[model samples]
Target chain A: MDAMQIANSIPMWVACGIPVCLIIFQSLLFMSKARQASKDIGLSDDTVKKAIRASAITSIGPSLVILSGMLSLLVTVGGPVGWMRLSLIGSVMFEGIAAGIGTQQVGVTLGADPMTPTALAMAVWTMVLCSIGWVIFATFSASRMEKIQHKITGGSTKRMGIISGAAIVACFSSFVASHLIKANADVGFYFSKNAVAAILGALFMFIMMKISAKHKKLSEWNLTIAMVAAMILTAILPIGA
Target chain B: MNKEQKTEYFENTYMPKMHRYGKLIGVIGVLVSFIPPIVLAVVFKAIPDWGKLPAAFLTGAAAFGFLWIMEPIGYFNILGPVGTYMAFLSGNISNMRVPCSSMAQVSAGVEPGTEEGSLIATIGMAVSVLINVTILTIGVILGTVVLSKLPAGVVGALNYLLPALFGALLMQFGIKDIKYAIGMLLYCCVLYVLIYLGVFSWLPSAANWLPIITAVFGGIAFKLIVDSKKDKAAAAAEKKDE
Candidate 1:
């Protein structure tokens, strides 16, 4: 059979489905524990429900974005693998890059050359191997991080909060900064629609937060509104161009 | 809850159970991740050249190895332990999981880095994983027909989804402390520029991680310095009163 046929075969679907199933199982398990803990901590059931609602709402746009990217993966790697990988432990960006690198190892570029079964094997191997590092690191080190945070903050909850807040701000700032600046061989550095999207997103979110403070009901939709507004403006305007 | 109850919940119930189950699931996840490739080899008779496997793995490692270690450590504070397990296993950490976690915390009015925050983050991440997987499944089954009909403009805008999410999240966190927000944003932008200009040539793949490391630790250091200075001033005022 050809690579595509093998990639979408029944066995392949069953094989890939295992991890996806595992992911769901793990999420459900952890979520149940968290629910119990939430009750123990005296958080009202309404708060938990609100969090679920907000998170579910916040997830749709990005998941749709991943769906679009999955189309490219579907063409390159076939449906089952693409569906499984993206549904489980891989992002659109990482999976594509890893697959390309894998195919290249066999002297074949992913989109440019005909895919052989050998290339498919290499691609799957590379994707899996590359991601293993995260699981391994987390398995060993996750439990230790709280101790590290404690040491850093000298066991003060307030100080820990400051450090955590600083870290999150730093992390997101780095992400935004990367999006805002683009380098071209000819242009040196220039902002693109991506930059506009980011800036507008921040601005819209700021406004939403201000308004939500008074309205309260608006808080649940703040992220969704900000993101949609920014995306629409960035798409329609030529500002950063 | 009272202090004693909170401590009991975290110490006796939450942390231990999460650690044990999380590690088990993680190990199983690693083992199961290899099944697809193994099946391809065994069932389809499509085995790669064993000799070239290392080179291919190295290529991916070279690109992503730093993220494997750094992402877990860097995202831990915000995600906490339970959220970390769910986030890594579910992927799309930055774009999907983190944003959902943050939104949940905000909507629930829970402070980040606290036990309540951790539970809320977990609920958020779990919901996102379920929702994300459901959407992905539907998209995979029906997307080819529907997506082909989407306008080019709409498709093009999809590219901005992540940047916009990051931007919104930055605002969400930034409002908590405007000074740190501004300072860290400037710090990251400057570091990103330096990396882009190849100023950090001696560092391997500095672009992937340098900005993140510096920004996270640098922000902490800056906050510490400012806090100590404030403490000093307060101490002087108290001494004068005495």
Candidate 2:
């Protein structure tokens, strides 16, 4: 093979480079904010760092395993349609995990990534893995702080109450409506991206609210709206993506 | 403790450590990006490649972009363990093509009936996925079971629920103008219609990603332009009122 051909042939590095970059970048950004948030909230740094480190370690094992799978597919079952399908699963799972069990509780969405099940499954394992560390940190570091222990909780119970009520209403409403019925899980990729974007924006607003002391109900309003919208998206969208 | 002591204790203790942890997380994140594909390539028996990077700048650039975008929206819960797990799984399935998060758009060699290791890995990944879904479904079902007990006409209530949640979330700081929301919605509908009609079939490769071509991109772009105009109008109105 020519130099170029030989070089291009090693598809794994070339292909995954962007996503990995995005992931790492995402992780670092998360870490930084977590730092700011901890400081802002008056939590101990070592605890937060420990949580992040534990999370990172827990996260990587699966990522590499998945990476191995992707390489196998590249050498086996390749195409854009398949790749798109994979992205569907990848994006949701990624977002779902980031959001926590609150997301996990939301059933399959119509617009969910075509691979939602896979993503969801990964999310379960992630939760399982991270919970171990979360418990450890909670037991030792955050023993005194009742509020902070639930940091990774994702408020699953509350979010479910909100999303399910919304979805049931939506579903029944669709049944009654003449034209605008509830479509099957039609979560487009853009929706996920937008959701991520909104969630992030709202997070900033929430942080700002906590730090400022002058709690603007408007920001709380923003948080509520964002969470609900995210839930609706979570509800009506998909089982796969 | 006195108020002064509280402030001093907080500033002296909490903030600095969080900052340091944040940096540590950032540095670790930068380092972690380079792993998955490398490991995967080796496992798949393919010759691992020299990727597009090895350049320090690449890592730095990646670090910057990720930090900026993620910092704004995250409470770190945004990086939920579940999402990462799902990502890893997607990576496994896409292994049939490319790894999850891989930049590769196409993996030319793959088709049905390839290598045993690859296929087995794919199947194994699939089974693992089924297990994951079961857990999530249980979560969903349990949630729905709770919702089932709520008051009647759930549909109508939630009709406003989405918008209500949106309003609550932004504290009414939505894409505030009804016109913009409608415009964005219409653009989405129309694009969906045309794309559904197969107009995209006629477009060239370049045109494939055309604003009119990709439903989401084109629609969002149109919406952004309209929203900006709306923003300007609102600003002008405020100025005039003042």
Q: Which candidate number maximizes lDDT?
A: 1
For candidate 2, give the lDDT of residue A222. Answer: 33
**CAPRI class of candidate 1:** medium
Model 1: per-residue lDDT, tens digit, A62-89? Answer: 9989988898888888888898889777
The digit string of per-residue lDDT tens for model 2 on B1-242 reads 44455445444664344335433433443333333323333433323112311222233323233322222122112112222222232332212111111101011111111111112222223233333333332333343344345444433233333322222233222223435333433444454445445566564322212322232233334444555588799999999999
> Fraction of the real A/B interface contacts present in each candidate?
0.80, 0.04
Alpha-carbon deviation at A144 in model 1, angstroms: 1.9
Cα-based lDDT at residue A86, candidate 2: 30
Q: Lowest summed-lDDT stretch of 10 residues in model 1 chain B?
A: B140-149
DockQ, each predicted model: 0.80, 0.06
Off by over 4 Å in 1: B228-242
lDDT of 2 by residue, A1-241 (tens): 2311222234533443443334334334433443454355444554443333222222232332233222322222222111222332343222233323312333323224332322222222332222222222222232122133133223333332222222222221111121111222364223332333334434544554464346432322333334444435544544222
Instruction: Report lDDT (Cα) of residue B188, candidate 2.
Output: 41
Backbone collisions counted per model:
0, 57
